[model samples]
Target: MSNVLLLFDKMGQRDIVTWNTMITQLVKTGDVDLAYKMFVEMPERNVRSWTAMISGFVQCGKPKEAISLFTKMEETCLKPNEVTVVAILAACADSGFLDLGSKIHESSDNNGFTRNTHICNTLIDMYIKCGCLEAALDVFEGMKEQTVVTYSAMIQGLAIHGQGEKSLKLFFEMIQTGMKPNGITFIGLLNACSHMGLTNEGLGFFTTMTNDYEIVPAIEHYGCMVDLFSRAGLLHEAHDFIKEMPIKPNAAIWGALLGGCKVHKNIEMAEVAMRHLQELDPFNDGYYVVLANIYSEAKRWEDAARVRKLMKNRGLNKTRAWSSIAVKGMVHEFVAGDDSHSLSMEIFEKWNELLVQMRLKGYVPNTSVILLDVDEMEKEKFLSRHSEKLALAFGLINTRPGETIRIFKNLRVCEDCHASFKLISEIVGREIVVRDRNRFHCFKNGTCSCSDYW
Candidate 1:
């Protein structure tokens, strides 16, 4: 490391390649801060130098800084190349800056970067991450030069956005185009089938993965299959699949089955999955929570309470749920009835107003999903104070008259919250999109795009 630094300092004249090599070395050695300092100190900067710095920042989990630097580079008359554009788009995607990503997409053609496959793939990924599946599809359709990477990007994007039919269509299209599907391609297809609950198709594809493509299923592939069968209420088949897995099942596999069991109220399977999960992850409270929910659904009050007691004894507490909304290019996060904000009183008042409107629209809270042993009124109050409601109230207060609100949650949106959002969408006469951990829920006119299936 010292030798490389000495060589870099001793160089009489530095070119773009020399600076790039030094920066790459520094980034590789985890000296991102020093590399960024050197980047600013350089008298002359080129596309490669800027790209290297941006990529380094992204690698170091500083995507916002990388994006800011990219903007600065553009302002300084340094015309971005294809590589630079791809790096910047990746930074935007990682940071969830959809508006900035759209601006980058508009500049691609004029900057002569549209023809590059890597840049196109990055653009597709950015649009997908921003929850703009239509834009992603448009970009995919316009790619005159499609490679395996391009096809995989489209497949993954479609799967992620819950457009399973379109994802499968593109899978067949890739085959017709004479491109062989790879491991990633199959993973995307399987995930799409899983999300769509296409059991037979998912099973057939899982078999084809090894028989036709000669590709061994990885743990993730198997996990998707487990999720597929378990989600379809085929608890026995899911159990057998996990038992017969080529690779030993991990916590993710058990977790998937446990989640399904909770949904189906399968106490037996939930117990089985929980046992394996406990062995795999002794300290994680997720398995315990799922088991408790299953017990609660089955009216096994003692068992449910026992699980909670075990969690407390093990010094494990439930993670505080949080939700976030993007407003004026800034993200605001809130916990359940969070009063720590400077405008807490205003937010609380707006929340009360929303509750009144929702109740007037005949919105009744579904308190069955709340596993806590609380009275009915307390449960209703707790449901109202959920993190999603807080974030939604914040969005309502901050956004203008006609703007749509988009929120993201770290966990599944509760049943009561989902109903409330439906009413909120109708009451405010605005479109609301909430991306939870599982899937996207677009609420408009008192209805969700998924028809409440999710």
Candidate 2:
């Protein structure tokens, strides 16, 4: 990379291709900031240069910047080609920019990319990630041809959205089309079965995946199977399955079991899972947090304190949680107790008003999710200021009463927030769609699409 840079630097008459190559190479080498600098320093940029920079932003986890650059490109009236469209679409997906994503979908159609399978697949993914499952399905249904990638995205989308039965139906239909299910296909199948508690069916598919398809199980496949059994409340069986695995169980495999243990309130099994996790991934704060959460759930305050102390001793800090909501094509983000937004006062006031109404609707704050050793009132206050709740309040303040509120969270939704969201949705008479770390939670009329299962 240094040599290439040096050679490019020595070139006296660098053209657009040379500049684009250097920027693309820098992006490929994980120097997105440098690439952006070069992009800015360029005498002028063609579509390729803009595309490269946008793609770099997406790759480097700067989706908002990618969206910003794409907007600038649009202002220039330089039509994006397929590559630019795909790159920016990915940014839209990552940042939950559904409004921009929908616009791109229309642009793609006008630009004669509707039949482009790759773009269509990306469209499906963008819609799914944006918590628009029906839109994703619409894109899938409108496709003239579906690849394994397309099928995989749709299947996973359905599974995560709590449409396990429909996901399985799609898989069977895929089989009828003679497309041949791959490892990814089976993973999606296993996830569907896991989410819906189709234990025997999941096992059957696992067996068939190996014997009939000759696909060797990767760590992900093994992880999915463990998740299946663990989610099904078969902790002992999941343990035995891990023991019998041909390869060593990774942190994800053990973590899946721990997650199930938390869901089922199996402290003994949760400890067992933690013992392995400590060895496999001791530094991962998520594992320690989960164990602490389990102890808190069981009212083992001392044990929870001990786990937290252990984390402190190991110099581990809990991952900061945040949630985002997009309004008027601009994304607004909130952290726990965040007060930095311009509408902070309004957000707090709106939430206070909603809480009064929510309480009237029989909403009692479940303070258990807060592991802190504080008074119940303090704990409830802390819970009320959670990032997602702030985002929800902000959304309610900014949007019309009947408008749907969509949010994206960086971590799993807490039990307290999940329960409160159901009541809040009912009180507000609007659909609240939240895409969290685990899955989609669409709350409407006092029920979640996940059926409170996720």
Candidate 3:
């Protein structure tokens, strides 16, 4: 890389090709900042140059910046090709910029690019990630030709949205089309069974994937099996399954078991999983937090304090939770106890008003989810400021009455917030869709789509 850059710098003159080569190499090497600097220094940029920078931002997990760059490219009147659209759609999806994504879909239709299979697949994925399952289904049903990638993306989307049965049905449909399911396909199938608590069905699929399809079970497949057992409250079975695995377990495999332990409140199994995780992923703060929460739930205060001290000694801090909602083409973010927003006062006031009604509807804060050893009043107060609650309050104030409130959170929703959202959805007479680290929760008519299982 240094040699190529030195020769390029020594050149008498450089054209777009010479400049683009450096930019592409910089992006590939994960030097997006330096690539952007070179991009601005370029004598001129074509669609390729803009596309490279935009794609780099997506790869580096800077979706907001990628969307901004795509906008600038449009201002310069350089029409984006299919590659550019694909990259930008990914940015929109990550940021939950559904309004912008819908516009891009319209633009693609006008430009005759909807027929492109890659673009269609991206559209399906974008819609699904943006919490627009109906839109995703529209794209899937309209696709004249479908590939394994298309089916896999749709199946995984359905699974994550808590639509396990729909995903299972889709898998059967894919098989009927004579599409050979790959490793990715089976992962989605197994995940569907895991999410829906179909332990027997998951085991059958695992067997079929190994014996009938002849696809070697990867670590992901094994992890999903553990998740299946764990989610079904079969902690010992999940543990035994891990012990019997052919390959060595990674942090993800152990983490799956730990997640089950958290849900089932199996402190013993959680500690067993953590013993492995501490060696495999010592720097990850999430594992420590989960273990501490489990201890706190069981009133093992000393154990929970010990975990906190270990995290502090290791220079680890809990990941602050935040949630985001997109309204009027702009994304609004709120952190736990956030008050920096311009309308923070109004948002809190609206939540208070809703709280009165929610309480009347039998809403009670589940204070157990508050891991701190605070008094009851303090715990309830802290629960009200959770990131998702703040985002939901902001959404209620900003969006129309009948419009759905969609929130994306960095972590899993706690018991208190989940219960509140169900009541809030009914009180507001609108649907609320929350996408957390685990899966989607759709609340309407005082009920959740997951049926309170997840």
Candidates' RMSD to native? 3.3, 1.4, 0.9
Residue 422, model 3, lDDT: 90
User: Which wins on lDDT, candidate 1 or candidate 2?
Assistant: 2
Residues 1-454, model 1: lDDT tens digits: 8988898889899887778888889998889999998888888878888989998998898988998898888898988777778888888776667778888899897776888778888999988776677788888889889898889888977776667888999999889988899988988998888778899999999999899999989998999999999888899999999999978999999999998887788888888888888899989986787788888877789999999999999999877789877678776788875789777787789988988888888877798978777898998878878888888888889999767787878788888898888888988998887778776777889997556655
Q: Please, what are the lDDT tens digits per residue for candidate 3 over residues 1-454?
A: 8888889889999999989889999999999999999999998999999999999999999999999999999999999999999999999888889998999999999999999999999999999998998899999999999999999999999998888999999999999988899999999999889989999999999999989899999999999999999999999999999999999999999999999999999999999999999999999999999999999999999999999999999999999999999998889999998989999999889889999999998888899898898899999889889999999989998888899989999999888899999998888899999999888888999898787877
TM-score-sorted candidate list, best first? 3, 2, 1
The lDDT values for all models are 0.84, 0.93, 0.93
Over 1-454, each residue of candidate 2 has an lDDT whose tens digit, in order, gives 9999889889999999999999999999999999999999999899999999999999999999999999999999999999998999999999999999999999899989988999999999999999999999999999999999999999999999889999999998998999988999888899988888899999999999989999999999999999999988999999999999999999999999999999899999999999999999999999999999999888899999999999999999999999999999789899997889898999889889988998898888888788877899999889989999999999998899899999999999998899889999999899999999988999999999888777
Each prediction's total of clashing residue pairs, residues at least 3 apart in sequence or on different chains, is: 0, 0, 0
lDDT of 2 at 124: 96
- lDDT of model 3 at residue 258? 98
- Residue 392: error of model 3 in Å? 0.7
- Which pairs clash inside model 3? none
Clashing pairs in 2: none
Worst 10 residues of 2 by lDDT: 365-374
**Model 1 pairs in collision:** none
